[model samples]
Target: MTESLTIVRDDLTGAATRGLIAAHLAGMLANTPVESVHALDLTELQHPSVRVYSAWVGGEIAAVGAFKTFDTDRAELKSMRVADAFLGRGWGRAMLGHLEREARDAGIRSLWLETGSGPDFVAARRLYESAGFSYCPPFGDYSLDPLSVFMTRDLDPASESAGR
Candidate 1:
């Protein structure tokens, strides 16, 4: 079935978003060590610098993603997740594309993110790679760590909007 997906800027404090954020966090905790689990909790997701997005299909959350601004041109991709029911259905990719467009709209020149370096994160890593993100050194407050894999992409506002 072809369902139209709606993307919205989510206020992570609400009940609908809170549940999804918690589920994403729980999945992160279950798969990685406490120290290596970098997924933001509900409170952190409420930070002023972060902007969260959710993809809704048929009135249900199919996927979610967020980005945190850093300086004027950089941002960190955060809290990306696809609901259990939406896995293998390209919802994650759709959510990611939405986030990228948002970043481009905001004049963000570079986008970076950190993900787990384990077998469980293989698919996530591939998703980033396919979306034009390349390996990079950790940014923001992150330090050199064996458990984290960092990736980045540079966006040009002029090029992205030229065709549109």
Candidate 2:
């Protein structure tokens, strides 16, 4: 935590970023059913609607996070992962706040995310909850599933209480 983190928009071509994303996908597939694994692949992360960012502590990639826009008002948080070496260092919360600022600055009004519903995801669930992301029914292209947990938060300051 002593090192400063610099978060930048990523092109997704760097090996560190790709490796972390691969790990994120592997974790998802290993923890959840294939049908309930909603994490985006490399190709999907490069889509025009998706924007990925990487947080670095000097030469080391601390974490990676992304969001996929659904029109102008809403977006889905995607691909958030802290490198194994950076775990327990508050990188997850830092990346989450960074992505929230990016989305809000770009005029996104609400943010949604789908994460695993299991023991492997307890920490993730806690992070989202602490950030005011309340549980919600599946949104967008998602459907109800036992292994999936959907949560959302409103970006507008006036509706912040409602989001919680």
Candidate 3:
């Protein structure tokens, strides 16, 4: 099947975007405990530094991702999810690349993220690893927990070509 991908700064005030995120978070939190997904609701997704992106395929939302800036040179990946039908079809990779590019454009030199250390999150960990992230100590409000894992990748301008 042919799919078109576009990444844009999302405005959560829109009902469609809110519905998409709500459904994604609800699904993620359904099987896993609330603490596992740790996803932000619509209100929290509106933080000043968070830039959300939605991937649309033929006018339907295919996936979603966000970059939450923590400082001038650092940011965190949050709320990344691909619709069930689109998983494993390279949508996740495309979204990650888009977020990385957005971070670079914003002058961020590093990106970090936290994911659950459960079977449900294994694929996500592998995805981040394949995208150049390496295991790292927890950052921001996170602390080491048996149920959590943290990863980070440096976004050096000189290494941009090699990364791609």
lDDT of 3 by residue, 1-164 (tens): 36677767888776656777988788777757766666777777888888898888876777889988999999999889888777878888888888888899899999999888888788999999888899999889887778788999998765552244
RMSD of each: 2.3, 2.8, 2.0
* TM-score head-to-head 1 vs 2, winner: 2
Candidate 2's C-alpha runs over 4 A off are: 157-164
Name the top TM-score candidate. 2
Q: Candidate 2's residue-wise lDDT over 1-164, tens digit each? A: 58899999999999999999999999888878788888999999999999999999999999999999999879999999999999998888988988888898888999999998888999999999999899999999899998888999989743323122
Task: Give, for candidate 3, the lowest lDDT window spanning 10 residues.
Answer: 155-164
Error of model 3, residue 82, in angstroms: 0.4
TM-score of predicted structure 1: 0.93
For each candidate, give its TM-score against the true structure: 0.93, 0.94, 0.90
**Comparing candidate 2 with candidate 3, which one achieves the higher lDDT?**
2
- Local error of candidate 2 at residue 6 (angstroms): 0.8
Tens digits of per-residue lDDT for model 1, 96-161: 888888988888988999999989899999999988899989887898889899999988776652
> In terms of lDDT, which candidate is stronger, 1 or 2?
2
Segments of candidate 3 deviating more than 4 angstroms: 159-164
- Evaluate model 2: give its TM-score: 0.94
